[model samples]
Target: MRPVIPYLVSAGLFGLGVFGLLRRRNAVLLLMAVELMLNAVNLLLVTADTTVRAALPHSGQVFALFVIVLAAAEVGVGLAIVLRLFRLRADIDVDAIALTGPDATVALAATSPSLTSPTCGTPSATPGAAQ
Candidate 1:
């Protein structure tokens, strides 16, 4: 019932969320850290609604609800992206994720002459056309 308890709790939650986000390497744990951050904000909003600002009664609660909804959508899309990443790479460690494979661009450049070729998009020979 202490007046400062809510503030302390919210601050602790936020701090833990930030720590988890920075420390975790797995994709799912990273997502959970983001959820922790969202929940911390929600708790702060509700605390302010009930105690600090009597003028605006339920506004903070309403905003908290919106945050919850946004967090839900974020989880859905985030998980799907993580699942796709897992399918492609067979691992979910964020440190292993890269914008491109180590040899992907180099292999493409080596095989495709289009970079310097005059007729890039057109194939050099038509298989069934008359010679």
Candidate 2:
């Protein structure tokens, strides 16, 4: 049996998942998209395993197993982070987490003298001043 059709379907599903992940702002939707991508990969791996059973043995299946384990761990950690962000900010928008903004950069530069000065050992006379 030709495996091209199944591979194409899996590719289409993966593409859809990528689209959803990029376009959706909700954390749950993003997680669902990630799960879709993982399933698409698993489908392709299984299809490859079936087609190359004689030559490749069970390598593809083993790889699929590893991917499933990794996906589970990723979902767990990703959901935890999402929950924490939602609790702190009351929103799940990925764009809002700007840790390196202009204000933050300026504040860090002002506070850290070693970061702005060329002389690493010499301390400035003014407290918190760059050397």
Candidate 3:
């Protein structure tokens, strides 16, 4: 049970996670890659708890539990976003998505005319501006 072995395993897992994140384009796959990275972190934390002499016993395990909780929450939100994107656009290709492109700007303006030129009919809400 060499300490270096666990460290190397954790590093390898993290590397694979990073590779998946970079190579995958589907939103669901991206979330899975992030979960892989989080699991690697949990493995590292548990290994540290076993190997290191800490003042608080099992602190690393506690941190790992927290990470697990955080990962669950992250997966929930990420899946919700992916599902919403799929419903709206009928696809979840992350590479094809653009939140701030010209089309997005135009769509926003089309949806909310008040956000466009204030002269469209809605009074500008800016304080001390020329009416």
Error of 3 at 124 (Å): 24
**Model 2 C-alpha lDDT versus the unseen true structure:** 0.83
- Residue 19 lDDT, candidate 3, scale 0-100: 99
Tell me the RMSD of model 2 versus the true structure.
7.2
Clashing pairs in 3: none
Q: How far is 68's C-alpha from truth in model 1 (Å)? A: 0.3
Comparing 1 with 2 on lDDT, the higher-scoring candidate is 2
Q: In candidate 1, residue 42 scores what lDDT?
A: 96
Scored by lDDT, the top model is: 3
- Compared with the true structure, all predictions reach lDDT values of 0.82, 0.83, 0.84
* TM-score list, all predictions: 0.75, 0.74, 0.78
Q: What is the lDDT, from 0 to 100, of the residue 100 in candidate 2?
A: 70
> Candidate 1 on 1-131: residue-level lDDT in tens?
45479878999999999999999999999999999999999999988888856698799899999999999999999999999878656778888654576454443444555433233644455469898
Question: What's every prediction's RMSD, in angstroms?
Answer: 7.2, 7.2, 7.6
